[model samples]
Target: MGLQNTKAPRAKRANIVMLGLDFAGKSTLLYQLRCKDVFLTVPTIGFNVDMIEMERDFTLTFWDVGGQEKMRQVWSNFLEDADGLLYVVDSSDKRRLEEARKEFELILKNESIKNVPVVVLANKQDLPGALNAEEITRRFKMKKYCSDRTWYVQPCCGITGEGLRVALERVATFARQYSRSKETFRNLKEMDTL
Candidate 1:
């Protein structure tokens, strides 16, 4: 029998988890998306949840988790059924870049998070000596880590919310891509059953 293919439908909702080293502005990014203004933020101790209508057809649930060394132990616990990852980096912190890289490796190695898209926020772009998106991508070997899924590195200033929408758009686009694949798989199964 011949197989017929059709366009898969997009999902109306998505759940994306925000992750990064401490002071990389994960919480600030969430606040900016929610209120359009950066409120003074303390270090996120556990997690923060915020929902946003990134576009008329797409809604997002962002899970911002604490990035401290101890807290990372619990990261995988929250990773069940995650749709994607939003990785924020303090682009100006040259000293801790290695630590950040190691932490990212740890996250990516978790079996629960395979094949999902990633949106990297090269944050603190407003600060002098901040690493640009290209540099951060290269330094972190992002292309290799993200080889199996769609990824985008967006330069941003979390305090001012610059490039936030662009990052969200990338996440939405990737989520749409993911939804299409899932739908296609389900359709294929149904056709086989028929």
Candidate 2:
């Protein structure tokens, strides 16, 4: 049901990694998308990988890694070949907004992931005290971290799948744009011969 895209005749593929604190709903969201149902998800010990077809001829491959402090040390290892990022945050946990901010900054610092587009999912929105877009943006100071690539903050609930589909669509749009730019650059370089 995941990856093993051998049967697909022709399709563009993009790999995206999901990163966030433990219980931020990363695993749950992945399950909802792939299986169309939710389950009692345990803390992702290491990582989980799944591939799903997105808008037309595009396959989105997701790598969801554990969010524990120890796991973060190895997060950079999976950044290789990644085309985009899904950054989940427990918006309801106001007490740890600063902590999430710090972790996010660290992710931004990683040179490998710096250039990739990012979609920040402010998860657990169904809970009380969930930070809204304004609060989240301020806490994460997202604009400060953003660069040439596209970035956005979306409030969502992983359990009920609210805002999940729209988020994916936006990310897929960014991925498609990136693909076009890369192809254009290659073509331009090929035509540069004297």
Candidate 3:
């Protein structure tokens, strides 16, 4: 008998939208994931996209959107199709945490992204006086805003690459679970209407 060649199936893909205020290190984090090295990045005026192969046979496609005040109005436009979300925060900027929370609350109101998995990266954790993940979570009122979604708060240093992989691994797990549950719900709904 001839041997049959077999190949592993392609990894499932997840679209993850990354957003935060300008200077939150969103662009730096993206490049860090892509190259596993620190990268100097300018403020993104529009958007940047990159794909990272993650654990659990899943590939994460990240959409790093611009976060200037003028660009906040268009954030909802990218939420409709996102499988997951990464909301970066400048943990050292304690004075502006409230502003960040307001923006996060607004984004969570979009119905299209309801129940999407989210990872809040409290970046700049290595800096002196930076808030830890738990503090950031409380400050953001994560339980209040993310009550209907799967969410996590991770303390990380974008430049040092601390906690990045662990955070994304959690994201992959949640994304896969959420995707399956959503599919099952759709199937059940369709069957009911039949």
In terms of lDDT, the best-performing candidate is 3
How would you encode candidate 1's per-residue C-alpha lDDT over 98-127 as one tens digit per residue?
Answer: 899888878888888888788889999999
lDDT of 3 by residue, 1-194 (tens): 99876987867888899999999999999898789899879999999999988766878889999999989999999898898999999999988888998999999988999999899999999999999988998999999889988899999989999999898788778877887888799999999999
Candidate 3 ranges beyond 4 A from true positions: 1-10
- Residues 1-194 of candidate 2: C-alpha lDDT, one tens digit per residue: 68776675868888888999987889998898788788899999999999989857899999999999899899899888778888999999978778888988888888887678899999999998898877898788888888666898988888898888888888888777766776788899999963
The predicted structure with the larger lDDT, 1 or 2, is 1
TM-score of each model, paired residue for residue: 0.89, 0.89, 0.91
Q: Predictions ranked by lDDT, top down?
A: 3, 1, 2
**Model 2, residue 108: displacement in angstroms?**
1.2
**True-structure lDDT of candidate 2:** 0.86
As for candidate 2, its clashing pairs are none
Cα lDDT, model 1, residue 20: 95
Per candidate, the number of residue pairs that clash is 0, 0, 0
TM-score, candidate 2, is 0.89
How many clashing residue pairs, candidate 3? 0
**Which residue pairs in candidate 3 collide?**
none
